[model samples]
Target: MGMGMGLGLGSNMQQNNSKEWVKDASDAQKGVNEILSFEEYVALAEKRPCLECRPSCKYIKDIFEYFGKSPRGDYNLFIKESANSTAVYGQQRVYEHIYQNILNFTEEGFNNKFILLVGPNGSAKTSIVRKLMEGAEEYSKCDNGALYSFSWIFPIESYIKGTLGFERRGEQKESCSSQTYAYLEDREISSILSSELRDHPLLLIPASKRQQMIDTWLKAFPSELETVRKSYLYYGDISKRNRMIYDALLQSYQGNLAEVLKHIRVERFAISKRYSVGAVTIEPQLHVDLRIQQITMDRRLATLPPSLQSLNLFSVQGENAMANRGILEFSDLLKRPLDAFKYLIMTMESRTINLQGILTELDIFFIGSSNEIHLSAFKQHPDYYSFRGRINFIKVPYLLNAEEEVKIYNDQIASLKSKMNFEPHALECLCLWAVMTRLRPALAKNYKDKKLGELVTTLNPLEKALLYSNEFLPARLDSEEKKLLKVSIQDVIREFENENLYEGKFGISPREIKQIIYEISSKGLMVTFVDILDFLNKFIDRKNEHDFLNIAPQGDYANPVRFIELLKDYQLEIFDHELRDSLNLVDDRSYEGYLIRYVQNITSLIKGEKIKSQITGRYEDIDHFFVKEFENNIKLKESPEIFRSHMMTTLGAYSLDHPNKKIVYTEVFTDLVKTLKESFREEQKKVIVNIAKNLVFYLSEVEDPEHKRSSSLSEEGRKEIEIVLEKLQGKYRYSQAGALTLARYLIKEKY
Candidate 1:
């Protein structure tokens, strides 16, 4: 038994000392293909060192580019449908600002500032940051978005397989390429010492020697150089643990830097906000704890060689520390005592933090968010000026466009893992109310001295929302007024930005609106527009507690209740139009055809060209009578021929500028369409009244509990109502409630 034990011990020792390293296919691929060597990393750094220095914005811009970007006045990309994604609506301007700032910061070396998003609660400040972090984390896992870190590959025989007889540690060999590390396949990696800081691999070199190497490399590629100082080359230091390991390896190698690098292993890493791999979120609390963590007194750690054991390597972790080399989000930044984060002034300027007397450097983008109340208070503080230059404040406000606002609720509804039915316009009703509460009346005082005053005075919140969305202009406006409104839109938006109380600065937040929807759904009641309206009405009653409720506008849209009434009136107008269409007695398609023919006739008359007549089936001179009839409806100040000539000139100029696009005549003469619709509505009034009477009879008969006799309709009456209802559903996308509402509106308006 004693002989057998001795033989077993000898066998184990032999295996440990002389075992061959059959390379792991997965690990080899990860190392050789996924990760870049020090030399390769340097080559990339020379061409695009911004990847290492400004990784946050670089990765963010990569995400932006991956999704794609649009020019300032173009918002189609921000709201386009994707197969598997919800469009990011209403923040195109914000995106442009952020993207442009990042470009300037990276290309122009504007790195001495932190981006701070300030807004009221629930204005998508945190949401924007969350998306950016998610995008960055997702991108970091890709080969194209690869980030790197290094580990000390110690020559411990028990952990390693090869390098049995290598006495000189610095015996370098020729690399396969000038951009790769020296060949050292015979010396397999053993103990991998990781770093929590994820410091740059270049930091492995001594400070003085690294600077000299960078200078020499830059000199070799003068064309790649820029006027901006390359301060980022020396941005951060190695973590204390890595520093200790590096020092120990250097000492063991008798102060030979090249020999020390022989024990290094380059690795590929991914960013994870949850694990604090490359991103982290910090609250205002005292959660930034950084203390020395002792190594576990387990066999693996205890059995370390005396050389490493003597170094007493320990790990430290904190919010800022974990977020090194990536992003650090200070959530609700101003919620805490300003003194707690006063070090930001220094950190932003120098990109370093004092960690228990050790000056730790960082290569991280710091993002902070604050509510308007806190920011307003912060602005009054004396220390505001002290931290001004280091911070760039971007205001995040509630969506001004009701259409865009509806998308928020729509997205939320789609995400709910529930199967509840929402009545059409329930979300729209809620969104519109929330938007109304947020809008500031166009301040006459601000624009009164300017030429935009008259237009601004006439603009209500609803009209302003339409303008902001670029959806539609006021249909009642004259051609000249419409032209002026379109031209001054940017100036109006700029005025809103400069307003003391910005248009979107005050409101019942989307969060509050979402909660109301949740409550309505949870009650198992029909989530109707009326129910949402009632919820908003009740919300207004709680104005004593919510300060935003007290923000009354200076126009007809002064109060939330008044705004709700205005919305109902607007809806009623819409209902009337829908009801006229729903009766299915008048043909709108015929009217549209007539309008198209009228335009063709006018065009031919102005050009003195012959036209084909649909009624006569003959080529004839342009119909002056039909053209004059449409022209009279337009109420043009110019004579009919002059008006026709002007329209032709406008169309000709438009066609010349937009050669690929066809000129839309209806868009140019929107008022004519409105006049036609109004004329058709007058013609259909009797049919609408008859339908309304039957609808009211149908509802009252079905709803009456006291009626003993059966409530019945004649076959012809039922057929008429059924045909109209079908048209309402199939053509107009109206629900049963919507049909009933429109019918009631028609009854009130016509009957």
Candidate 2:
């Protein structure tokens, strides 16, 4: 019976898995159909049409925005987050600039220029490009993101000499159409020809006659279709091999255009950098070859029509050929010899490259990345000025905000295949120290006013980090300046920018941090903040071995140990606050009740009227003593009536500012809670310190196994310690060890 039940369960599980698999397959097939003939494609295009007379850059931009949402500004399809899935941290400015340039190219046409991303090593230049290519590939598979290409269909009538038999294979049925023949036994079969370049089928029409044909076709269309027709009018010509096939087919058809068009088979295609389908990445290699091949030896070619059999049947293949109609990324484009890549400048401008003396037309967007060092060196080259116009340079720098930097680490940790324990703030502490190394001292001259100048001069790396993260403005600024700071922060960040001393241009890269994390985890030990700091200190010690570490930040930031201490202090402050809050020393409910009671009594005092008391069920005058106690708690030292009037006025102004929203007392009086917490902590200082000391003593006494000893506490002592322990664990969510650690740290600080 057990065996039967197990079999039944296994069978049910298999059925459920198969159902899920089938559903996924159906969903995948619904999005895109990968095959289509010329007529079918033209019909699809007519139904779902593009109405923009712009370059391929517009299409590229559209593809980018299709997969990602826009950033802050209210612009159409302007993506601020460029690193869609690649997890590039904190380079929104660079992404926005690159996006704007791509949009500019919609009006500029083919300028023979490439978007050159320049940054320091390990600054995620390659990551940005990979994300873009990945997005394009995904976008192409979507309905609105459709792209089309075609392959040649060579009829094979000569294979069996017209002797054919029909047979059924499985449940398949043969359908005959003008574009394709129905074949069962193979005598009337046609060999489907493939092109390496994946040329668009419309390119079969010669450029001289293509414009007139498109214009005549456009005239029959609705007025709304004009833009798409006009934009497509500027499409590139066919490849050399496709041109050869075209010439042979035209000769065989006796120059009949309609007959030649009959063999054209349009196929739907998507961008794939991995498969080299329309998206290609080229590295500097010894051989730079883009050539056409003749296939006269294949048995398939022998079966072709006599006109095609005698003539050379050609197909093009290479990096340049495969990347046609899409994107070609030149990785570390400047790493190659100048002579090797020099042709790009001319090819970019003319939209044509002379390959083996053949003038090939290219309708592709070019992108490349290079380290800033190489880019700087290349800028000094005599040919730099000539190539400058053909390149759009963008800077991808390390992240300035520690919070965003932490995101990079968090994402990496999430992607790890194995489970590893990480102490709280382990990643955050690393991010803090890493970001510190990247910051430059704020120059006083960058500010406009003397006060602002002084503020800028005193802007330590920590404060600058907070500013970059938009966490808080320093208290030194006035109310108006504080408001203005948020708007002008971006400008402040770029104020002292230079080729060598930019804020984010220098730092320990995320790659190194990831390596450190890996090394720590390899020991099979749980990683803590202290462990990470120790590893980082060791890494910094070997500064002479690595270039980036050797080039330290200016002044106080030059010492790695000092920076670690700063991070420690920051973490300690957070722990102290949590410790104080966990004690339940500040009663928010009590404070709110008192505040409401005071507001009521003061209202009565200000109005010179008596209020009915719920306690006595009788009318009574405002109790000055009761009101004064509430006032003293908040340190509101003024005339009680005036204080009450001021509170009402403050709420009124807040209501005006946030219309239609309820007035929140805590939000309006933020400093009031802070002041209350301070006062309460002072009142219970001795009690808190004593509890912290006793907890440390208890843990220390019981921690050892061999010397296990009783804590020797009275019933009240045990209850008191347990109360604080429960608050720490339940309220603050601290583990037993974490609670112990907090106790020890608190005892040392006596708070």
Candidate 3:
């Protein structure tokens, strides 16, 4: 009975599997049937006129969704799931420039110019173009971004002679009344001639008649008609090969356009970088990008009609032809000799490539990349002016913001995390040092506001890096000055944007940082911030090897060695905070609450109003003594009255700036928070020192088990050390070994 039940279950499963397999096969058949006849394609065009003849720029714009404008005025092209998930971070200005150019191309018709991405080496110039191509390829797989092209289908000799009336007998027999032989079996077809140029299917129609039909269909979409009219569809003709076949068929059919189009097959094609269908990349090689060859000698076409066989049919075959209807990238374009690519001067402007005097029309977006050195040399050439008008340059600089720089490291760290452990801020310290090397000291006189300008001039490399990241305000500035600098951050960023030597142009590239990270991770030990700093220090000693390290110091910038020192100091501050937090002396949230309460009291005092205390639950005068005590703790430099007035002004401005939003006191009063933290650290200096010493002692004993028995640690001290180590591991994601290393570092250097 059990065996019979098992057989019944197995039979049911088999039936269910058969049903699923049938459904999948049906879906596959539906996909195969998506290739439409010429008439069906026209019908589709009527339904979606804009999508049918959308320009490359519009197609790219459709691939990425607009994610609103960033705070820096850069338009965010949000990386959608469909766009192949390639993310280019921290190049907002570059994206915004490209987006604007795309808009211009879409609105102003074909720009007849190449989009050139120029940058220093190790920047993401190639990555940006690759991302766009990848997005285009993925977009083509969808119905909305579907691209259509045409091919010539020649039936078997018997069918062509009898059914297609190629024999021109007294009476023509129609064995097949179908408009197209596109669905004919491969065995039944003699030749299927596809264009390497991937000519648009609509190009088969006479230009005038095509325009008339498109206009009629596009009347319903009046807004899109203008754009469609500007595209290659409205202007481009069939390739030379297709044109020859079309003309021969028209003559054979006695000017019956319908009969000629009957031999035309319209199929949906996808852009594929892998297959070199429409997206192509050309390396720096001394070879012609385009060429043509005669196809009449091929045995496959020996069965062709006398009319087509008599003509010398040449096929366009090259990178330029393969990249038709999509993007073509020239990697390190300037690396090639000037004479090699000089054809670009005319090709870019005319939208055609000359192959042995035969001009093949192109509808492709040309993109090229070159490093600063190559581009600089190219600029010195006499032909620079000749090509200048045909090129649009967009700069891709190394990331200046440490926060964005850290993102690149974090991605690398994520993969290494399972292999080993990382102490808190390990990657952050490296990113900070790299960004510091990229910053340029600000010129006080360059600022429109003299006070703000002087404050800008005072900014060190670390301070500028932090400002660019929007992470922290410089601690030296008061609240109002801090506000000025905060508001002027965008201006500060763009101060040298138009200049040839920009701040981000000379940074230690993220590539080097990743190499450093991998080298450290390969040790198979706990990675600490000190390990990163030490590695960078040793790396910088080879100044002759790295150009950025050899750069002369400009005030507090461009000094790689000094930047390491600054990073060490910054790490000490981080360690002090972490150690204090582990001891539960003063957590940020509690301190923030205390600061908020103090601000509230001060505001009431200035307004001459009573304050309702949460503890007292009664209206009372402002607590002047409590306010003074808090002010003294932070060591307010200004008088109490002036300090209170500045505080009121800051609060008022914040309220106005962020209407209906709850105030985050710590964020608004960053300088105050820094000062308060410093004051707290100074007050508990002795206790922190004692704890560090105990942590070092405990870790040393743990490492040497023999010393553990003779250790002089009291029971309370031992428990405290254990709690700190536990908190470090659990709260901060530090492994036991990492925490122990940090404890030793702090005791030796920071304490």
Identify the candidate with maximal lDDT. 3
Clashing pairs in 3: none
Query: Which digits, one per residue and each the tens of the lDDT, describe model 1 over residues 1-751?
Result: 9999999999998876655343454554563345445665667766755454344445555666765645645334345554433456687667677777777555544355778898788888777777667666766766557778775555546423443323223444344223122223334433456667777787776777766666665564442233123445443458777887777767876886666665555677777877887778988786543445656453445444456776655666777777776778899999889887888888777766777666666667778899988988999999999988888888888887788788777866775536565766667767777777776666666664454677677877767766776546786665556666777777777777855578778877777777877877776535556566666667778877778777655665657777777666666666566666666544545665676787789877766789987799888987788877776655555566655665666667778988998666566556666667776667677776666777777766557768665666666776777787787778767767556655655576547
641 in model 2: Cα distance from truth in Å? Answer: 18
Model 1 lDDT vs. the true structure?
0.67
As for lDDT, the candidate ahead, 2 or 3, is: 3
Q: Count the backbone clashes (under 3 Å) in each candidate.
A: 0, 2, 0
Give TM-scores for every candidate, taking all chains together and pairing residue i with residue i: 0.81, 0.81, 0.91
The best candidate in terms of TM-score? 3
lDDT for 500 in candidate 1 is: 55
**C-alpha RMSD for every candidate:** 8.4, 5.7, 4.2
In Å, residue 677's CA in model 2 sits off its true spot by 3.2
Model 3: per-residue Cα lDDT over 381-402, one tens digit each: 9999998988899998899877
- Give the CA lDDT, 0 to 100, for residue 404 in model 2: 71
Off by over 4 Å in 1: 1-56, 70-88, 108-110, 157-192, 205-229, 234-248, 287-315, 415-420, 444-451, 522-531, 585-588, 591-593, 600-628, 631-646, 657-664, 700-714
Q: Per-residue alpha-carbon lDDT of model 2 for 1-751, expressed as tens digits? A: 9999999999999999999999999888655646555555556654544421224676787875675653533222322234445456577777787778776665555434688988888888887777777777877887667777777665555532332322123333244333332223233456766766666555666765655655555555544234434343445667677777778878877897656765666666778888897788988564573666667776777656676677655556678888877888889888888988888888877778886667777767788899878887898899999999888888888888887778677756765526565656667778888888887776677777666666666666766777887556754443345545656786678875654667677778888888877887776435556667678877788777666567645665655767777666666766666677766666676766666677778888878899778789898888889977767766755565655666788777788899999756767665566666667777888877776766765776557656466655556765777787787778766656666665676567545
lDDT of 1 at 132: 67
